[model samples]
Target: MRKTATTLADGRELIYFDDTEPYTSGAATRELRDRRDLDPVAATSTMRYDVLTGEWVTLASHRNSRTFLPAVAECPLCPTRADRPATEIPAEDYDVVVFENRFPSLARGAEPPATDHVDGDDLWPQRPASGRCEVVCFTSDHDLGFAELPLPRVRTVLAALVDRTRALSALPGIAQVYCFENRGEEIGVTLGHPHGQIYAYPALPPRTEALLRQSRAHHARTGRVLLRDVLDAERRSGRRIVATTEHWTAYVPAAARWPVEVHVAPNRDVADLTELRDPELEDLAALYLDVLGRLDRFFDGVGKLPYIAGWHQAPVEEGRELGRLYLQVFSLMRAPHRMKFLAGSESGMGAWISDTTPEAIAARFRAIAPGPVPS
Candidate 1:
């Protein structure tokens, strides 16, 4: 893949990952100039410490005015055309492009307040939400989704993600990086475009922290990697296993809280995407596409299911040895034409109640899978 980085009209960074013949061979080049007149990005978000949970809550008030669902003609994610107003991407067409988010929750240039405490209270500390957020356009075609992308295109997208993860991890004050996709209106996706997001956080997220604690405790007790042990147990049981490749495995977690949840983990220990070998990455592209396809077919007559797919990577400076890379894909759809809503038990308290068992979910997935996964 050939990566070309450029600056947007408003000074934000935009990158193109070209994998096609002309672009990749250097016979042609991507349009580097963004000619549209755009306002400067002013990131005024702040991070407030949640005393009760010990987590940082980013307050991006400006995001309230972000672009919502728009008509196809006015979709900002579409490639810019001469006949139409310019969109976010200035190129006439692109294979895969990534740009800094216009409405970012955390920004690299955010300014913190003079005082550290909120209203002189030591319990509530506040700081600038200094980090990065980028949008990855899976395909220029708005009608196409990630699952429908061709194998080469999927590999290109994966390359872009790996590149961003490595670069974002090196940024100042970035403790952890997260790459995720939120699909469907039910999942609160504002745009109809097939895209994902990368978040470079200033601190480790609560989920990462929890995973680290558990892994550390497990290592102390058993002298073995926690996730590796879990994977071994799942493979031994084979009850919750959905699919397995030479370098990866997909299974429904034993304690899955969602109605439909699957965890895809690499067979070998890898802390992050950057550590993946070429063969592993290739296997990942195929296995991930296969899993996503099954998810769409999970509930008959449901059409495209609303789900969230997130990458869990280790922190840049902490828990590197114990961290294990994995992908968690889950949906809110419990049945056809029905959705699962997080109510009192889930929303109020930090507890989850599963509507279905992991074994049952795995059985359904196996039934829909297209036989054994390719070796």
Candidate 2:
């Protein structure tokens, strides 16, 4: 397969992939917007790909369809009571299970794929839809989140992620593996369960592609791995660093795009958690749980503080080796009851304006008590 891409006049990224065996060319396009142009309350849902930048955009208007507060009995992810059947339970006893989504936005059945239209009323060129999404049930217990999970359980969950990445990447048409978890409804999680999502895509994701390209360029110029060098610098500076062990370190990013963004990277370079030794995985998991616990302490045990956590691994392909794996976790909520909404400047202009200082946030996190971990 031959891949080609270029930037558009409007600063959007476009990529195309050509296959010799299949005799087909696949292309994708996307753009960064200032604000979503949709009725968040009225539109049930809509998915679009911005041709200029080459990224998939999913607008879930139904997010605001229901009332803000729902009874615990009505929670879809909750376990069934004595009178209810076992079907009402999200899953049986399992540490982590990957299953097909019941209500996925990128369903295999979503019709009239964006690539079908060469030219429509207002739609510019779009790319074919070729991606699969699976939900990773983190734990059987509804109350156990990443922060609450025992260290050994967290390692099991990370192992599950590694297994899923290896399994999904080996599929016939997968090029990228995206694993992410959204905690709390403030981050738009409908279900209040301890679960995450895995998206095995047929093509390289735009943001991943951009970071990979940047890492390659940086490596070419410096003859050193980008993330490894950055992690070393953070350790040497000892300012933004929040928590660190022999193998891993967690710190506030110097160029954070969000107010409460924290990045956890290996003290040594590794492609993914799968590549780490068992001991290293345990250390990493310990740090992960510690940081999350501090986050909980930061907001005085506000469990509903919305946050997103994900593993950014190198592409599954062999050629994309310059990239290093890292975990990026950020909260949309600036505080317990406050949110940082992406309005006009952030949504339409592709610019981020943060109100708090990274230094201050790092200091605040550092002051929080690091709870003991079993590992």
Kindly report which residue stretches of model 1 are placed more than 4 angstroms away from their true locations once superposed. Answer: 24-32, 371-375
Candidate 2, lDDT over the whole model = 0.66
Candidate 1 has a TM-score of 0.96
For candidate 1, the C-alpha RMSD (Å) to the true structure equals 2.6
Best by lDDT: 1
Q: For residues 170-266, what per-residue lDDT tens digits would candidate 2 score against the true structure?
A: 7776777788998887666777777788877666777787877777888889987777788888889989999888888888988887868789988
CA error at residue 288 for candidate 1, angstroms: 0.8
Clashing pairs in 1: none
lDDT for model 1: 0.90
How big is the positional error of residue 46 in model 2, measured in Å on the Cα after superposition? 10
TM-scores of the models, in the order given: 0.96, 0.77
- Whose TM-score is greatest here? 1
Task: For candidate 2, report its TM-score.
Answer: 0.77
